[model samples]
Target chain A: MGSRIEERFSETKAAGRAALVTFVTAGDPNMEDSLALIKALPEAGADLIEIGMPFTDPMADGPAIQASSLRALEAGQNMIKTLAMVKNFREGDSHTPIILMGYYNPIYIYGSQRFLDDAKAVGVDGLIIVDLPPEEDQELCVPALAMEMNFIRLATPTTNEARLEKVLTNTSGFVYYVSITGITGTAKPDPDAVSRRVALIKAKTDLPIAVGFGVKTPEQAKAIADSGADGVVVGSALISVMQGHMKRDGKAASTMVPAVTDLVRSLAGAIVN
Target chain B: MTKSDLNTFRAGPDEQGRFGIFGGRFVAETLMPLILELEQAYEAAKEDPAFEAELENLQTHYTGRPSPLYFAERLTEHFGGSKIYFKRDELNHTGSHKINNCLGQILLAMRMGKTRIIAETGAGQHGVAVATVAARFGLPCVVYMGATDIERQKPNVFRMKLLGAEIVPVTSGTGTLKDAMNEALRDWVAHVEDTFYIIGTVAGPHPYPAMVRDFQSVIGIETREQMMAAEGRLPDTLVACIGGGSNAMGLFHPFLDDKDIEIIGVEAGGKGVETGEHAASLTGGEPGVLHGNRTYLLQDEDGQIIDAHSISAGLDYPGIGPEHSWLHETGRVSYVSATDSEALAAFQLCTRLEGIIPALEPSHALSHVGKIAPTHGPDHLIVMNMCGRGDKDVFAVAAHLGTDIEG
Candidate 1:
């Protein structure tokens, strides 16, 4: 079977527009609501879905995603529950690529081989482990590739030419270009600078390039898409939208799914237009 | 057991910054370039004679090193077994072994032309040490301290402020050492251009564990010479507390090749390990990644980090140095735990007998000494690293013991 990530990018290319990659923490607030949100995402214009396996210490994340993970954990989210949520989402949706993103410890503890088999069985198409750099390929990257799953690599403003080659060696599915040098949702990226870097990376790899980290609003998504990125990824902003609609006790405020889906819809519209 | 034959133990952390499978640069892509540059700069600085001379000069004159190694006669008598010696690192300028690392790192930051310094503190000893050096160098310093630490370690917090360092109170996680470290890492990523992160322990990425160990090894280096001078032979055992395991690493690295010497690292068993309220990473946790390296960490079944609890603020950390993990696996060091009550009793015993009020960190080690010292014969000499002074911990200790202190 072909990779869903490759198929989705190809479909977007035929449509002459960048894919809208939407990210949400699995089991955030609660598992049932999070599964409902995932089921509603594709219909709401998300071309690709990224589910965060909520971790206790998300050092690379900003306040928004960090709090989201904490809420998920407090609501009794674990690896089993997170994978079950993905399996539940796969029941209605079979086409939209689902990418699990987070640190490596959870997977390492869950047993890498078991995690790979379970993820593949549950229709997880790719992974974006933030802490596993290219230097740590032996730990997860090589094994994930062996399972025919895309081990997505992140390239940053600081990833020089020499380092970029190492990053691209085992990376599959797509390359995530973090436009800023800081954590998520903290700063804005310059569209012109991102365009130059995207062109530079495109010159090196044939894979799709998705720009994220600070691409929040519809306007920012359009600016990044116009800069030659194959996909536009938004995470913290979507999480913030859900957080804004959350009640005082951290339960979803009835419109939480709609608030997230509405933002994804706007971002998708901007990328396609 | 000679220094020439010590190559096997000394030549660790190969070119990849790993002590076996423990240490590596497990960080995001955004910080990769900065860590690589730091590695290069550290390599050059390690070889430069000028850097050596400068660090030596500061160690001797500024920080007052070659700290005296004193024999605890009364304590040894009370135990009625092994003779005990104290490696007096607490007598240093900042009242701890933390200054040893801060001075070396600050010099490197100066050589690299970094304008700002950022650090993470657990018990606030490292914060004061970093703030002290930053003040001396006339550089702006930002210290991320957990709010829980700020409340318990108020004296050290005030010292950092008096030294003109800005304290960023972290309320994340359990509001302690682990949370403070997370905030510092986030700050380092944002200010990578002009900022230099002085990690206070033998943890973090490659150069940090190796580099900080190199700086703090003065404790072991001096202890070896002092023990030989005092007894005309090497001590049979070594003991020190392990939080991030800096002071213990400092005291253990030089003697790693000496196969006859027994090394013990004491961890804080808050209430007890069985109660699940402890900072005994090697004793209670499994190997995992946090801060920057893969080491033994207190984490849940799902790999989410668990908050560590300890009466001593400095020992309340969830992870240990990667080198310690490698050493524990290699059977070079035996890791054990001392309960909060045990350490408190040891603290009072040492103050009454030795007239030296030891910090709660080393009191954990002292508690272990109380156990093993009585089991050994008189010919066995034990060297314990008195890593910090206890003045900063007076308020916390009083509160824990329920002593009503009159103003």
Candidate 2:
């Protein structure tokens, strides 16, 4: 079984700091650089990592992440390369958990059983596939759990109490609560309102809740922690930083990895009590 | 109608929505909450006089419904068959039956207080229809199209853009209609609140198939009256192509009570059914669940859906609508296949013989007319629902045949 997400939550809580979840596109720029960032993330103070398994179309993601996915795909990244990258991550850092987030079709194309076996073998801790809804858990969730890998559910602000309960019931790993009603990178979430909702979900679920989809900065992360969230997930903001660094003419990109990691590091410190 | 007559044709899925062994609410547990809400809202809307009045008004005003039942004299004579009548759905504001459902769904979206309309399209017909309604209601519209389809159907892409809809070309999973659907569903998951997913066909979770079918059934409702008035008898045969089977089922539904009528659904046979290249779900597929309902699917032995191929993009789906599956199993409608060669022949036949170019999707049905007309003879009247004109397919068809479509 892969390392449990709760293990990190407990560690972060004992240290009096909210868990810092950083998202990076798996093959962004290329596999080599992405692997470096994946290893660098934990050292840079990110308590957890959400590794984007770049699908050709990442519909739920906003411009930054989507563009990064395009760049990754153009650089010849697929599920095979993505899993290989995770395998590399496992070689060095065994404590930090990695979640593979993307759509379902790639998994469907790659045999579900084969994928589960491969993901588990590579030390992938979980998945946050936007397209694989709770109804579709039979396709991958069972196998993922059987292989001891978590299959995280992306819960939204509009996910009502009843729907939230159902999502929570089926969910295996931590729940990534989207703070806003809009697409990723689009909404500027009201932290107080998001926290109240998170608190309600927390009441319903004994599982850890890592709020995502708009928690983009140190301030937002600190606010989410204050509001009773176990973890604060930041994705688009770091992507925006990386994208801003890379020139679009499609040449080699130097590692803004250090600069982006600096931002996540600052957020991680802010989340520390 | 007599009890004996009602026995001739089958309606339903009776009210509770059961179509023989197929179709019952086989939705995901999460959507159950939303589905219940929709069912209640639809029930109230169905009974409200204001709802019907508003729909009737819009159908008349915006869509120009009650389109002419065009009698194809030249083509009928050349084919030497029973007289053929075209339901001029092509005359509807968007030049297809798609708008009929779009207007209704867009209105429902408005009533539900949604500020955004989202849809996935295969051939761009549904995208155009949804965009048209979005413009009329002044809602922000977003369309998801497979990157491949976006490149193929460029004109329709421009049409949607001109109508003020944002087009997001989906670049995943073979980038076809199915991929577009996956992306659209993902969009709905993120923006479920204030967004009404305007599904293009009679597919998706429960209420959508039934709802879209109901809206499109106006095609049959109009054709039935027109044919009855003109021929003084119902058609001996009713034929239309099936993709998600919306257009076919729409025209066939109202005629279900008429025992004298024989119904046929033409599926795309890319090369030929015998060559293991076809979309003839009832003929070749096994029963399986896909796109939210249990239906006949063209899946491999491993239960993986095989990619379907067709000269016509609209008719190349790997599965049939659950209701159509029910109709096929119960022998209410005969499902058949038409090859690329056959459909192309029919496309050329219609243009040369009748001066009306039918879309490749409906031309599958058009090709079947030759086989059936000879068996039934000229005395037996067959009314084929010519669902669309051949504009979008002209480029694809012409390039295949090595002939340029003259302006």
Q: Write down the C-alpha DockQ for each prediction.
A: 0.78, 0.12
The C-alpha TM-scores of every prediction are 0.98, 0.76
Q: Which candidate achieves the best TM-score against the true structure?
A: 1
| CAPRI-style docking class of model 2 based on DockQ | incorrect
lDDT of 1 by residue, A164-230 (tens): 9999999999999999978888799999999999999999999999999888999999999999999
The TM-score obtained for chain B by all candidates, in the order given, is: 0.98, 0.94
How high is the CA lDDT of each candidate model? Answer: 0.93, 0.79
Per residue, candidate 1 scores C-alpha lDDT tens digits across B291-314 of: 789999999999989999999999
Model 2 chain B scores worst on lDDT over the 10 consecutive residues at B24-33
The prediction achieving the highest DockQ against the true structure is 1
Consecutive 10-residue window with the lowest summed lDDT within model 1 chain B: B1-10
lDDT value, candidate 1, whole model: 0.93
lDDT of 2 by residue, A15-86 (tens): 877798999898887888778777889988988899887755455667678778778877878888999999
lDDT of 2 at B254: 86
Docking category of candidate 1: medium
Model 1 clash pairs?
none
TM-score of 2: 0.76
